[model samples]
Target chain A: MAEPLLSIEELVVDYGRIRALKGISLSVGQGELVAVIGSNGAGKTTMMKTISGLLKPTSGRVMFDGKPLTGVPAHRVVKLGVAQVPEGRRVFAQQTVRDNLVLGAFLRLRSGQKREVAEDTERMFSIFPRLRERQDQLAGTLSGGEQQMLAIARALLSRPKLLLLDEPSMGLAPVIIDEVFALIERLKAARDTTLLLVEQLAFRALEVADRAYVIEQGSIKLAGSAKELLANPSVQQAYLGAAATH
Target chain B: MQTLQLLISGVAQGMIYALVAFGYNITFATSKTLNFSLGNFLMLGGVVGFILYMTHNWPFFAALAAVVLVGMVGGAVLLKVAVEPSLNQRSAYGWILATLAVGIVLRNAAEVFWSTDDFKFRSPLGDSPWRFFGEPQPDGSMSGGLGVYPQEVLIIFVSLAIVAAVELFKRRTVFGKAVVAVSEDKDTASLMGIDQKFVILFSFMLSTAIATVGGVLVAPITLVSATMGTVLGVKAYSASIIGGLESGFGVVVGGLFLGVSESLTARFVSTGYKDVPGFVVLVLLLLFKPSGLFGRAAIRKV
Candidate 1:
């Protein structure tokens, strides 16, 4: 197997005495789409936050590309080729759709690739045509699904090697959820982007992700390939209850 | 003719107030903190310019440039000690006191250097009488029966220029766009490679430089004094509260409105009551529309 793109070892996080993540260890290989599924308060979001540098880990190691990421700030993480689409579609609501996308390429300007950046933005528009239609409109006015698309597109604009998404399909219609999933699949296929996704949607996550980790109460209860875990009786009981067994 | 004179004076005074109000908006928008010492920065601008001209014998243009440059430096220093450190600690109140202390120190230091006596600097616009439709006073004053001074015209011109330039920059430049992003959401903006602390410092410097210009413009009419900026700062804050600090356009409109109204009140009503109306408007605005007239209300998702 190729070298892991990201590795977390013995990561511990606390919210003022309440332990959110307890010594969790996980690793993802290059171009792999890894899904982390757990109920609310199960430490999944906390893990993503720790990796992205939004929240510092109390103890443990986060290594990206063989470098320690313990003290890096969130924005520097993007510079190191990791971008996060934060929970709740925090898409700079007051800005125009085009402005939101422009900010995604903030660090790219230093690389002196303006023309390619413009082309990438055009490609993003083509992928999400609705965004192109509402390019001038304020992001706050976009519909729920469109906002989600904007959020993902904004993250993709950074041209990150690894995309970390937190609850991308939350509160979306079933059809829109499928569309978002399809977009994620397309991104991974075309861009060779590594994905570490946190989702509560069990079956859909397993369908898109090559490997899965089930977390509960700040610890990982199980981990395996999608097909193997889907067949595992305990995994089914923990995530899908009686439906998966059926 | 007298009514035209009052209108000219109102516009000039309004221009000065608008600049100060914009300064308040810049720091408030980016940092969500107030520099109660804003007026002192304005005072420093004029005092510094005057010192450069009268004491150091610098040319008018050079003195003006020196004033602006020094104001920018002062703003950066204020940000480093008063704003940035406080922001790191998440202590908003520390910025308030720290900025006020800096202002106090700067003002007193100026007093020691310049003394308290008022001095006149020749207007670059000269003694030319600009009459809209009136005869010069019998005393040969340029009031031209309208109280319009040549320097006041300069004040109006400079104020409009600064506002127009800032608006264009915010719309067209990459740096300006990044500033808007930081103002909208600091954490997310930082995630996009924006150094928000630096942006905040740059914004405060820009605002202070503009305010210093406003001070230099109006210093001829109102004698430059260390204490001159305190009341002006309060009035400008009132204007910001009136305009809605969230929107730049709103801040300017509110400033002009307050300036003209204050001028009218001072002329017709008691000068003491001139600021009263502004403070009343401020209270009413906070009570009724905390977002200001042009500010958009954000929804709390949680």
Candidate 2:
């Protein structure tokens, strides 16, 4: 079998005294969507940040496309075809939407791919047409859902082989959450992009993910096909809350 | 006529303060730290330009170019030596002391090399005053006229031009946009593949180069001295705070307002009380709108 696109082995991360991720391991094959679902404070965000080189892991090895990601700076990680839409959609508030999209292709810009960057920006506008209407408006003026779309669009403009999205459904209405997930689903179907999704909304994430991992209190408790996890009685009780006595 | 002269001089002086304040904004915006050595950098520009032009008989433009290049390198060195080390320690006030120490050293070096006495810096534009709107006095002498120095006009023109160019760079270029991105959120900027360290270094270089330009322009009027940057730096800091450190245009407005107030106070009250009005306005502005007249209130994100 071909090597997985991303491989994490026994990753451990600590924030001072508190251990955030304790010996967690996961992998995603080429063109696969992997979901890691857990409640808040379960270290989901920490794991994602560690993988994208935002946080330094205490002891671990992260191999992305056969390169070690550990100790590498976050900016250099993007050049390795890995892009992350960080939690809370941290868009440049004072900048225009178009500028945000353009900055997303900063690596390409630095390499003197001006024409390609412009073409990629136009491509992003097509993917998120709402952005086209508000292209000139400051990203701060955008609504939560619109900002989320802008963040996703900005990440997509980087043209990454692997995309890590941390809590894309965060702080949006249910309808907007569904819309965002639908957009991700469409992206997966239309492109060969590998996705590592960290989400608190287990059911929604499991519905679209090809494979799933259940992380609780900084460690993975279960890993299997998404369909299998959804049907598992324990998962239904813990995450779905279907068999709760209360 | 007297009031108009004061106003014109006030505007010219304000432009110098605005230029210095704008330099403060550049580094502060990028790294959230101010280079206290900024004034020393300005002194270097004036002193270097004077030496190259007057002492060595170098062309004026060549002297100016050499000063700018040296200042740029000095700024980068400051970041590496003073800023990066302090930041690495994660201590907020460490950089304050580090940069302050660097400033003192630079001032001392200049004092040793150029002496403590002030030196006249000849402007490339001749010292002859251009008289405008003259009206004959009762004794058949020109009384109601404006005496404008060519260098003063250049100061005002260059101030506006620098501000406009920086504004344009921030809006139009990819590198400029990277700067904006890093300023807004460093983590997100890194995710976009921007090296935050490089941006910070670039801002320092830009800031120092700007201070050098300010020094060169004002030296003709103010005289070149090792310690000249001290008062100018303090006033520029006040200007930046009064206008809102985050807003470029606000700093200019604050600078002009402070300048006009200082001149008016000097004429109406006493020259000894000239600096008082700027401090008074700064205090009043801080008491009321701490963000500054044109500064935007920071938005809190959960």
Candidate 3:
């Protein structure tokens, strides 16, 4: 395997007195889609937050492409090409959809190069045509699925090398969830984007991810190829339900 | 004719109030906190300008530039000491009171340095009377047509120019868009590499500069004193709240509206009760619109 692009070594995170992540270690190669599968409160989101610099880890280190990401602020993290599409699709509700996306690449924008930003925006619109349909619409008014799409599209505007997606399929219809998954698969294939995805939908996430880690109570319980994890008896019992167990 | 002149002067005074309102709007849009001490910044503008012009003997343009630069610096300090600390502690009220405290200190410091006596600011636009339908009479008094002084014209033009410039910047500039982004979601703006702290600092500085200019321009018409900006800042804030702090155009229009309305009320009604209409509008706006005339209603999400 190529040298790891991201390495989270023995990372531990705490929320006040509560230990959210306990000595968890994982790595992603330069061009790989890795998935962390867990139920709610399994520390999947906490891990992603810590990596994104929204939350600080109590111990261990997050190294991205050989750079130590210790105690860096979230905004500065983005400049290093790590863009996180946070859970719940927190779009800027008051702003228009286009403004929302434009803000994604705000740090790099120059006063004289508005046309360039517009072009990048148009590129995002082409990938997610639904967003193009409502460019001027307020982001808050978008439906849950559209908001999810908007969240991802906005992240893409940052031209991220590493895309961290947290629960992209949460609270979406079956069709919309499929659409989101399809887009993720496309992004991984076309852009050569490194993805660290946290998801409750194990089967769906594994379909796109090359490797999978099953986290339980803030520790990695199992790690294997997508095929191996899917065939694991405990994962089938706990997450995939009785139908998969059979 | 005397009454007409005072009414014109009152409108000019109102315009100054509106300009200060714009400053309050800038800070309020970003942090949802209005600096109650905004007036002190305005007072500092006049005091600083007077010192530069009269004491330091700087040219009028140089004095104006120096005062504005001082206002910007003062704004940055206000954010650092007042805003940043309070935001870190999740205690927003500290910013309000801290800023107010800073204002009091500045005003008192000015009093001690400049003394408590009132003084008139020399108008850079000169003592020439302009034909606002008529010229001034021989007796240092405006006569002929609907006589107006050139300084009043300068005041009108400058206020309008600032408003126009602000509107253009907000709409067209990249920094302006970044500010809008910051206002919408600071986290995202930061994530995009738009330095959240820098944007906050810029907004405060820009806001104070405008308010300071309002003070500088109107000081000639009103007495330059420590108390010059206290009531004016409050009234201007009322205008911002009434005009929707989010929209740059709304601030200017709200200011003009307040200024013109106050003049008309004082003319047709009681001069002593001129301020009553502005406060009444503020109360009514809070009770009814709450969002202000130009403000968009924000919908809360869980």
Candidate 4:
């Protein structure tokens, strides 16, 4: 079998003394959409941050595209084709939407891929037409849903081999959440991106992801194909809000 | 005519303060730290230039270039030795004391090398005043035109040019944008593949370079002394605070306002009270609009 695109082994991360991620391990295959679902403080965000080089793991290793990314700084992680859409969609609020998108392609611009960068920028605008309409507006003024779309589009502008999205459905209206999920579905159907999504919206995430892991208190409690997890009684009881017990 | 002359001189002096305050803004924007030794950098520029040109017989342009290079290096050192370590501790006011210590060290070092006495810095532009429009004197002798020293005019022009150039660079260039991005949100900038530490270091270098240039320009007017930076540095800090610490344009406006007020007081009120208005305005502005005239209050998300 082809090697997994990303591999995390027995990762342990600590914030001072409290272990945020305790002996957690996971992997993503090429062209796969993997969702890790958990409640708040379940180490989902910590895991994503570790993989993207934002946080250092006290023990264990993160191998991305056959590289040990344990001690690499966050800025260098982008060069390895890993883009993270951090929690809360931290767009450059003072900058214009267009500027934010352009900054997403900062590495490309720095490398003098001017023509390609411009083309990709246009592609982003086309993909998110709402963003195109508000291209000149300050990103802070955009609605929450639009900001999330901008964040995702900005990540894609980097043309990453792996997209780490933390809480994409967070703080959105039900209709907006549906729209975001639909966009993710379309992205998955395009089949050119590998995504590791962390979500609190378990049922919705399972519906879209090909495989899912249920993490409780920084450790994986269950892992299975999305269909299996969706049908499993324990997952249904704990996450899906269905009163089912195995 | 007197008022016009005061206005011109005030504006010229104000430009120097603006330059210094602008330096403060550059460093503060990237790292949220201010270099107390900024004024010392300005003094270094003038004293270094004076030593090179007047004492060592170096040409004016060469002396200026050498001073600027020294200022750049001083800025890098200030970042590494003062600002960066303080920031690493994440203590709120640690950098303040650390940078002030650096300034004191620089001032003492200058004293050791150049002596404490103020030395006349010969202007490369010559001491001749440019006359714009002369009026007839009471004794029937023509003495009407407003006369401005060429160095003062140079100060005005260079300050404006630097501000414009920096504004353009910040808005147009990718690297400049990275600096801005780092200033706005360091974590987000890092995630965007920008090295925040490098940007902060570059800002300190730029800040010191600007202060050095200001010193070189003002030296011909104020003369060079090891202690010259003390009052000027305090006033520049005042100018930055009054202008709003975050706003670059605000610093210029604040500097000009403070300069004009000081000049006007010295002329109309009393020369003894010349420095009174800047501090007074600073107090009043702090009481009312702490964000300054052109500064926007920052909004933070939890």
Clashes of each: 0, 0, 3, 4
* Candidate 2 lDDT by residue in tens digits, A1-246: 489999999999999999999999999999999999988999999998998888999998899999999999999999999999999999998899999998998888878888987887888788788999999998988999999999998998888999999999898988898799998899789757899999888888899999999999999999999999999988997888831221
Would you list the clashing residue pairs of candidate 1? none
Task: Please give, for residues B105-149, the per-residue lDDT of candidate 3 as tens digits.
Answer: 888988887768788787887665555555657876655666666
For model 1, the stretches where C-alpha displacement exceeds 4 angstroms are: A242-246, B90-92, B135-147, B299-302
Clashing pairs in 3: B134-B145, B136-B143, B137-B143
TM-score of B chain for each model?
0.90, 0.95, 0.90, 0.95
Candidate 1 Cα deviation (angstroms), residue B151: 1.6
Candidate 3 TM-score versus the reference: 0.91
**Model 3, which residues run further than 4 Å from truth?**
A111-119, A242-246, B1-11, B55-57, B135-142, B299-302
Question: What pairs collide in candidate 4?
Answer: B133-B145, B134-B144, B134-B145, B135-B144
Predicted candidate 4 versus true structure: per-residue lDDT over A1-246, tens digit per residue = 489999999999999999998898889999999999989999999999998888999999999999999999999999899999999999888888988988898998999988998998898888889999999998888899999999999899889999999999888888898889898998898878999999998989999999999999989999999999999988888888831110
- Tens-digit per-residue lDDT, A108-151, candidate 1: 86578789889999999999999999999888888889999998
Measured against the true structure, the TM-scores of the candidates, in listed sequence, are 0.94, 0.96, 0.91, 0.96
**Candidate 1: what lDDT?**
0.83
Give a tens-digit lDDT track for model 3, residues A106-185: 75575345677779888888888989999899888889898999999888877788999999988888888889999999
RMSD (Cα, Å) for all candidates, in order, is 2.6, 2.4, 3.2, 2.5
Per-residue CA lDDT of candidate 2, range B170-241, in tens? 889999999988988999999999999899999999999999988899999999989988888889889999
Candidate 4: which stretches are off by over 4 Å?
A242-246, B135-142, B299-302
Question: If you assessed candidate 2 against the hidden native complex, which CAPRI class would it receive?
Answer: medium
Write candidate 4's Cα lDDT for B1-302 as tens digits: 78998999999989989999999999999998888899989988888888898889899889888988998899999999887788789788999999999999989999996698998888889987777778766885556578888998899999999988998888789888888899899988988888888999899999998999898899989989998888888899999999998998999998898888888999999999988999998999999999888889654332
By TM-score, the better pick of 1 and 4 is 4
What's model 3's lDDT at B84? 82
